[model samples]
Target: MTRASRFRSLALAAVCLVLFSVLGYAVTGDRAPLDSFDVEGRNLEDWADDSRAFIDVLRVVEHLFATVGMTVLTVVLVLGLLLRRQRWAALLALVVMVATSLSTSALKVWLGRDRPEWQGTDFSPLSSYSFPSGHASSTAAYACLLVTLLVLFVRRASLRRLGIVLVVAWWLLVCLDRVLLGRHYPTDVIAGSLLGIGIFALGLALVDPRPRSTAAHAEPLPEVYASERRVAVILNPIKVEDVGQFRSVVSAMARESGWSEPTWQYTTVEDPGTGMAEKAAVSGADLVIVCGGDGTVREVCAELAGTGIPVGIIPAGTGNLLARNLDVPLYLRSAIDVALNGQDRAIDLVRVGGDGIEDTHFMVMAGMGFDAAIMEGVNEDIKKKIGWVAYVVSGLRSLMFPAIKVEIQVDDGEPTTHRARTVVVGNVGFLQAGMPLLPDATLDDGILDVVIIHPRQFLSWITVAMRVLRKSPIVDETLDRRTGSRVRIKASTDTPRQLDGDSVGEGRELWMECIHGRLLVRVPR
Candidate 1:
C-alpha cells in the first residue's frame, strides 16, 4: 500500500474508533443521554407490529442475516476465493470476518446493555446483550469485504458500480431490519456498523489481498542462454484502464522474471498490432506479450509466426477467443505469470482470403452470414460500456437473419450446395463460455472444422444451440459439420463476413487454409 492509502485507512479506523467510543459511553448506565433516542426509535417496530405480514417478512430478513446465515456466506466466499487462487484475499476475508464477529461478542458482553422492553413477543426473545447488534456488524463487514474484492478484481467499471450498489442496498436492508424487528436500537446498529467498518479498515491496512508478484513464488528456470533475454510488449492503449499502471506492472514482472526491461509499443488506429509486432521481432525479442482483443492477438500472432519467439497473451477484449481456446487465464496478473514462467506450445493459424477483403490470418475462427451480421450490427458505444454484453444484444436482434445459399468444398472434394443461416470455420473448437460450436476442432491439428447452421424458423435456433452444446454428431440440413486442411465457402450472393469477431464487410467467398504448428504461445505448465 502507498503511504497515502495507509494514512487514509488509519484515519478512517481512528475516526470509527472515536465515534464508537463516544456512542458506547452515551448508551451505557442508567439515565444515559441516548436512552431517549433509543426509546423513540422503537416507533418503527410499533408500526410494524400492527401488520403480521410485514413482521413476518422482517423475521425472514432477520434469520437470513443472523449468525448462522452469515457463517455460511463467509465460508462460501472464502472457498470461492481460494478456488480462484486468490489465497491472500481468502485469508484476509476469513481473518477480518472472524475477528469482527468475535470482537462484536466481546464488546457486547462488556457493555452489558439490556434489550428494550418493547421487543416483539411474536418471536423468541434474545437473551444476549443489545448495545452492539450482531446483524449490523456482520453485514457491514461482509459488504465492505465484497466491495474491496470487486474493486480489486473486477475490471469493468459499470460492473463494479453495480456490485457496490447491490452490496450497499443489502447492508441497508439488514440495518433497517434490525430496527423494524425491535432487535436493536438505532444507536446500537450505528455502533455495530462503525465497529465492523473500523476492523475491516484495519485489516486492509495490515494485509494486501492482491496476489504476490510472480517472482515471489516461482522457481528459477534452468539457464538456457548466456546473454540477457529481451522481452517486448505490444498493448492496445484503450483496452486497459490505466496505461501507466499497466506499464509499471508489466515492467516489474519482466524484471523479476530476469528479462531485460520490455520495449513497449502501443497499437494505433492505423496499425493495430502488425507493425508493432514486426518491430518487436526485428529487435531480437525472445518473448513478446500482446494485450488486446482477438483481432489484435491475430495480427500480432500472424506477424510473429515461425519467428521462434513465444507470444504471451493477456486477454483484454470482449471476445478473447484465442486466449480462451489456448486455456490462458483471463486474470491479468495470472496471465502475466503464465507468460513469464509457463511452457510454450505450438498452435495452428488460419490464412483466410475473401472477395472484398485483403488476405489476412485469424487465430480463432472465421464466420459468414448470421454470425458476421451480429458482429457487424454491434453498437460500439454500448460495447465499450458493457463489454461482451453488446454481443448478446446484437445476437438477439440478428437471430432471424435470412439464410443464404452457399457452396462448401473440403480439400479436393466436389463442392456441395446448401442454404445456411451461418457458416463458421473454427481453428479452435469452443467459443466463449466453452460453447462447443466445433467440438472436433483442435488448434494444431492441421485442419479446420466447419459448422453450417440453417435454422428455418426462429424457434429452430433452439435445436441448433442444443446440438452444438451437446456436441451431437448427427449432421443434416438443420446443422452440418465438415473438416479438411483446406476449406472453401462461396455464398450465392453478397453476405456479411467476420474474422475473429471483426466485421470485414460483405463478401461472397472465403477461402481458409490451416497452417499447422505455425506459431508458439505460452500456456500454463
Candidate 2:
C-alpha cells in the first residue's frame, strides 16, 4: 500500500484506540476490573503473578524505546534531509506509535484521579494513578511502529516477519508483565495495548513505516529528573564571574520570592552562548537571562527572538549597548537584583543583512560606515584599558577618512541617495556603558530610530564629533531621521557595518527591519 494510504489507515486505527481507551475507562474505571475472571475461572491470580517475571525485563525495554518517541520522529525527518527514498511509511508508523502512547498516558492519568481498590505501594512504579498502563501502551505503540517499519522499509518478507514476530512477542509480554506484577488489572493492560495498536494504525493512515536512510536512527538522551516547571541558564561564568556572590544573592532573593534554586549552565565562546540558550528553551526554561557584553546579548537575542520568554540582561562588557538603552544597572549587585525583581518588558530588535550575508539581531542599533569602521578598529584590550575612549580615538580616525555613499530606502518608501560618514539605526537608543544614543528611543515603542551622517570639511567633522560626544540627537535638514517598521538600504559603495557593537562582514545592499514588540525583558516595575 502507498505510505499515505497506510498512514490514513494508521490514523483511523489510532482514533479507534483513543475511543476505546476513553470509553473503556469511563465504563471500567470503577469496577473490580479483573477479579471477575478469577471468580469465574480457576485460581488464576497466583499464576498470573508468576507470569510477570519475563514481562518485567520487556517492560524496561519498552519504557526505554517509548521514551524516544520524539527522537524517533526527528530521525525520520532528518533522514529525508540526508537521503531520498520511500521513508514516509516509516515516518507514519512511528507517528502513530508515539501518538497512541501519549494518549494512553494521558488517559491513565485522567482516570487515575479516582483511586481504584487495587492501587497501592505494590504498583508504585506504575505511577500516575493508572487506569491504563503506560508500559502496555508503549509496548503496543512500539510493537506496531517496529512492525510497520519492517513491513514498509525492508525488502525481504523474512526480515519483516522476523521484526513483526519480535515486536508482537514483546508487546504481549509487556502487557502480561504489568498484569502479573499486579501493577495493572487485565483491563488496564488490554486497554493500553489496544490504544498503542490504534496509534500505530493511525501512522499507517498518515505515512509509510519504512527506514528511508541511515540518518533516520536517533539516540535519545536519558531524562534526569521529572518536573513540569523548570529553568536553565547558559552563561559565561566570567560574565557572572563572582559566582559565589551571585548565587548567594539570587538564592536568597529567590527564596524570599518563593522560587526554587535555578539551574545554572555555562556556555563557551566556541559553542556560543546563544546556542546554549536555545538548548535551554527546548529543555523548558520559563525565563532566561544573559550576562555579557553586546555580542553575547545580541547572540542570545537572535535565538530568543520569538520565544516570548523575557530575557534578563546582566551587562558585563565594556560597551553594554543594549544594557545602556534599557537602563539596566551596570554594577554586578544591581544587575543581579534587577534580574531577580525586574518586570517583563517587550522590545524591538533590528535585523541587518547585506554583503556575503551577515544575519544579525540588534537590540541597540545598526551602524554603517564611520561608526562601523571605528567599531572594527577598536580591540578588546583597548576597550578594557580605555573603555569608550577607544571608540573616540577610532571615531576621530574614521571622521578624517573619505565619505561612504549609499542608497537608503525605508519600508517600500522612496529611496534616497546620500553621502555620509555613518548611518545608525536604533531599536533602543544607547551607546557604550549606559550612554543614551537616541534620547527618545523607548523599549515598548514600535518604531525604529534612524540617523544618517553626511561628510563635510574639518570644521564640519569637528561639529559631528562634538555632536556625538556631547550626545546630540543630530537631526537636521540634511541628516536623515526617519521612523519606520521596515528599512532597506543598498550600499551605493562598499562599506563596513556593525550590529549591536560587533563587526560583521561588509555588505553593499541591505534590508534592515524591526521585529516589533517581540522582545520580553525582566525589568523593574
Candidate 3:
C-alpha cells in the first residue's frame, strides 16, 4: 500500500477510537449527556410500536443480520474469495472480522452495561450486554470489507458506485433495526459501528490484500535472443478506469520479464487499432500487447498476421471471447504476467464480408438475426453501468424475434434453405459462462462451426439452452449444427449482424472463410 493510503487508514482508526471512547465513558457514567440520545431512541421506539407491520418487518431484518446470519454470510464471502484465487483478500477478511467480533465481546463483558428498561419482550429475552450492539458492529465490518474489495477489484465507476450504495444501505438498515426494535440504544449502535470500522481500518493499514507480484517468485526462462527485447502497448484509453495505473502496471511487468521500456500507442475513435498496430509493427516491436475489446484484438492480429511478431491480449471488454477460448487469465495482473512470459500459439482468424459492411476479420464469432438484434438493442447507458448484464436484459427482450428464411452453403456444398431465428458462425466454441454453443469448435482448426436456432415457441428456448449446455450431439430442426472452412449465409431479407459481439449493422448476406493458423497470440504455457 502507498504511504498516503496507510496514513489515511491510521487517521480513520484513530478518530473512531477517540469517538468510541468518549461515547463509552458518557454511557457508563451517571446522568451522562449522551443518555438523552438513548431517551430519544426510546421515544422513536414508542412511535414505531404503533405500526405492528413495520415492527414485524424489523423483526425479520433482525433475524437476517443476527449472529448466525452474519456468520453464514462471512463464510460464504471468504470461500468465494478463496475460490477466485484471492488468497490475501480472503485472509484479510477472515482476520479482521474474527478479531473485531472477539474484541467486541470482550469489551461488552468488561463494561457490564445493562439492557434498557423499554427492551421489547415480543422476542427472546436479552441476556447479553447492550452497550455495544453486535448487529451494528458485524454489519459495519462486513460493509467496510466489501467496499475495500470493490475499490480494489471492480473497474467500472458506475458499478463500483452502485455496489458501495447498496453496502452502505445495508449497514444503515441494520443499525436502524437495532434501535427501532428496542434491542439497543442509539449510542450503543454508534459505539459498535465505530469499533467495527476502527478495527477494519487498522487491519487494512497493516495488510495489503492484493496478490503478490509474480516477479518475486518467477524463474528466468532461457533467452530467446542475445539482443534487447522490445515491447509495445496498443491501448484503448476508454477501456480502463485509469490509464496511468494501467501503463504503470504494464511497464513494471515488462521490465521484470527482461523487456525494454515499452513504446505506447492509443487507439482513436477514427481508427480503433489498425493504425496503432501498423505503427507498432513498423517500429520493430518484438511483442505487441493489445488491451481492448475483441474488435481491437482482431485489427491488431490481422495487421501483424504474417509478420511473425506475437500479440499479447489484455481483455478489457464485456465479452472477452478470444481470451476465454485461449485460457488466458482475466485478472488484470495475471493477464499481464501471461502476456509478458507465456508461450505463443498460432490461431486461426476468420475473414468476413457482407453487404452494407466492409471486408473485415473476426477472431471469435459472427452472428446474424436475433443474436445480432440483442447486441444492437442494448442500451449504451445501462451497459456502462452494469457491463454484460445489459446484454442479458436485451436478450430477454429479443428472445422471440421472428424467424427468417436463410440459405446456408458450407464449403462447396449445395445451398440448403432453412427457417431460423439466429445463425452464429464461431471460430471458437464457448460463449460467456462457458456456454458450449459450438461444442465441436477449436481455435487452431481451419474450420468454422455454425449453429442454427429456430425456437418456434417461447418455451422451446429452454430446450435449446439445455441442449447447448449439455453439449448434446443430437441435432434436429430446433438446433442444427454445421461446419466448413468457408461458409456463406444469405438471409431472405436484410437482417442484423454482429462480429465478435459488436454490431456490424444490418445485412442480407455474410460470407466467412477460416484461414488456417493465420496469427500468433500469447497464451498460457
Top model number, TM-score: 3
TM-score of 2: 0.53
Off by over 4 Å in 1: 1-31, 46-83, 94-114, 119-131, 198-208, 212-216, 466-477
**In terms of TM-score, which candidate is stronger, 2 or 3?**
3
Order the candidates by TM-score, highest first.
3, 1, 2
Candidate 1 residue-wise lDDT, 215-257, digit = tens: 3376666657765689899999999999999999889988887
Clashes of 2: 27
Q: Write the per-residue lDDT of candidate 3 for residues 1-525, one digit (tens) a residue.
A: 889999999999999989998888888847478776688888878888889899999999999988899899999999999987788889989988898889889989988788777867676758789878889999999999999999877778898899999999999999998888888989999999999999999999998887765433566556677656899999999889889999999998788778999999999989999998999989889999999988888888888888888999999988889999998867788788888888789999899999989898999999999999999999988888899899999999999999999999999999999999999999999999889999899999899999999999999999999999999999889999999999999999999999988899998999999999989998876
For each candidate, how many residue pairs have backbone atoms clashing (under 3 Å)?
0, 27, 0
Tell me the spans in candidate 3 whose CA falls farther than 4 Å from its real position.
2-11, 14-22, 29-33, 214-216, 412-415
Q: Model 1: what TM-score? A: 0.87
What is the descending lDDT order?
1, 3, 2
RMSD for each of the candidates: 3.4, 25.1, 2.6
User: Candidate 2: lDDT of 458?
Assistant: 63
Q: Please provide TM-scores, in order, for all candidate models, with all chains considered together.
A: 0.87, 0.53, 0.91
